[model samples]
Target: MDNRNMSDIIESYLKEILDQKNQIEIRRSEMADLFNCVPSQINYVINTRFTIHKGYKVESKRGGGGYIRILKINLLTSNDYLETMSEVIESDLTESEAHAILEQLYGNNLISAREFRLLVTIFDTKNLSTCEDLNKLRSQMMMGLLERLAYEELE
Candidate 1:
């Protein structure tokens, strides 16, 4: 039996389609039916998995003929991704959000494994438990990393 849960299976299915093309239009009800799940489950997966920060753009339409459009944003080309990612970081960032950004960078080969590990270590809340505002610290570290990436390309 597969150990992965419903959400993982559904996400993989959608990504499989996305790999073939940059965009896909899906009906929530149909996706739920195909996966033997409820429509709300489909909504949950889309909302969480397909986010702008994670390199996906999602558009949803509600009602009888409603559909969800997912576009895999290909901003990974060139150093522009670093600049774009820098702009997206807010004043505060949760650990999960930080990991998402790091994972995206590593997956896109923008950062080497060593750099990825260094960032992950620096951003770990456990290492910064003495600080009252972990999120703010994380945001600063992320921005610093983005700046370093841009500077690295200049060398």
Candidate 2:
């Protein structure tokens, strides 16, 4: 029931797709041979993990020349948005600066309305203690969070 290996395989395959600029064409048989698994294993991984919920687009063909294409989904203008987010996190950001960045994502339709609200609420100034060093902590935390978001597990 754990299916850890299955999950790991799926994650690794997803990473390969992402690393190759979100474009890949591999035959099911070739992939199965490489993984030392059956073709259905490949199909199962694709069906479960490469879903839109996780921000990917998948297409496939059937016949003598069948292939699969996996595209990484970006919420439009994502590159520019990520660059700006990196800048804001790198520099000294006041409460207004943080708020503005979140607002921009909300306005651009990058983040859902609920997610935007939750993010704003979690990073609220009211939650921090007077003696706690918020600026330094926020900068460190932001970088770590960004790294986690940016890096994907390899297949």
lDDT digits (tens) for residues 38-110 of candidate 1: 9999999998998866878898788988889999878745477787778889999888888888988898887
lDDT of 1: 0.87
What candidate 1 gets wrong by more than 4 Å, as runs, is: none
Score every model by TM-score: 0.89, 0.47
RMSD of each: 1.8, 14.2
Q: lDDT of each model, Cα atoms only?
A: 0.87, 0.65
Sliding window of 10 residues with minimal summed lDDT for model 1: 75-84
How well is each residue in 1-155 modelled by candidate 2, as lDDT tens digits? 66579557766866776876856677889988888888898888877666543455689999999998887655555554555466547534455555665665576665679988887775567754472777665566555544444442111
Runs with alpha carbons beyond 4 Å of true place in candidate 2: 1-4, 78-155
Steric clash pairs (candidate 2): 12-154, 12-155
- Most accurate candidate by TM-score: 1
> Model 2 scores what on Cα lDDT?
0.65
